[model samples]
Target: MSIPPGESAPNVSTGELNARYDKFVVDLLGVIAYGELSAFERLSSDARYSPTLHDRAALGRMAVTEFEHFDVVRARLAEMNMDVELAMRPFQPSIDSFHDRTRPADWYESLMKAYVVDAISGDFYRAISEFLDQKTREVINAVQTNDESGALLQDRLKKMLADDPRLASRLALWGRRLVGEALTQAQRVGTEHSFLRGLMIEDELPAARNEVSTLLAQLTKNHSRRMSQLGLTA
Candidate 1:
């Protein structure tokens, strides 16, 4: 299922909505925390594939940033008196599967994967943040700010593509594949996590369905623009 817009919880009392929203926040943070942790590991692993010492170190820096992001989310969960490990556990399998299936074949593929996939997920999180409480929104915003990996990946990929126009076709295809798998991953998470699904839609209303379609359209549009920036097809 596509992510629906941030609509009020339907057919619930204020207190009930509050409780549901709290659960939603925890679930959101849990998934994002796990994602950051996974990114840290993946980038560190991908560093070995880097063609230059400078590139390897750059990836190492990004990996550290990801872990720092993870730590921020972990602290938030702890403050909520939630078991951080338990909160992140449910998302582990699906997220791990995503990485396993999309593992890059080479340095260029790794760069594209890191850039395109991370941006898509960031967009999704920002979209969901609209309906969250002020404090939770601040936490989400804090972790996402000052991300330099996207810029680094974009610059490197652009230069690489410019030097060898032949890579455009292959990378474009890879970008599309990454988006496809990302949407699939989103669907899996939404299907499996009821509270997270509740944040997006309410009781399966038609308007809710339309909102979901709109969100998906926006994500796709943003993704296509990102691909264009990288001189690739969406």
Candidate 2:
């Protein structure tokens, strides 16, 4: 409950005194947890796009890993004495909208989401993971990382382009849109959150304003190189 007119309770328990610490833990983790859930749904639904048994199994395995992360978040919330549903509710719309509006049409597109979109998300999450406390750090580390899929993503992008040169241009455009949408979503949250805005600024120095731009530029260049290997436009 909120503090009474003349009386006050601390913003967090004495045990949880770091306001920014607690905020980062709750905000960043909740977002990551929601992503796990969405990934599960997207992969399960989109696996049908795959033409081969091996591709379908790979996507299913990725979805299963995402659900595993979801389970970790569920248990972590209970330990924190917070309601998981309450922590998760406000995020449903935004997360749902992000995945919904970017549905992939084929197997390649699905892997692209798993690769490009998920990699950028990992970059963002890793940024906030540093601010958390010990237990929080352990939890963050325990949560899933996409190293396997990430490696495969790079390999597959090269092979796809080598096999069909014309596929490169279309995939390049698709990658650009995917990155752009993710940045727009990020910009939406950054403007709406003072703590995150401050933290991002703190993370960058003389070029704080250009930090995200630079990161995106790097992502685009990497994406473009991958495209070129496929004989696609940057």
> Where in model 1 is the C-alpha error above 4 Å?
1-11, 145-147, 195-204
RMSD to truth, every model = 3.4, 6.3
lDDT assessment of candidate 1: 0.83
TM-score of each predicted structure versus truth:
0.90, 0.77
> lDDT of each structure?
0.83, 0.66
In terms of lDDT, the poorest run of 10 residues in model 1 is 1-10
Model 2: residues >4 Å from true position, as ranges?
1-17, 195-234
Cα deviation at 215, candidate 1, in Å, is: 1.2
Model 1 lDDT per residue over 163-201, tens place = 999999999999999999998788678668863455543
Lowest lDDT sum, 10 consecutive residues, model 2, at 1-10
- By TM-score, who's the top model here? 1
Candidate 2 residues 96-210, lDDT tens each? 8887778877777777777777767766655545544567667766675657876766786677767877776677778778887887777665555432433332323345446
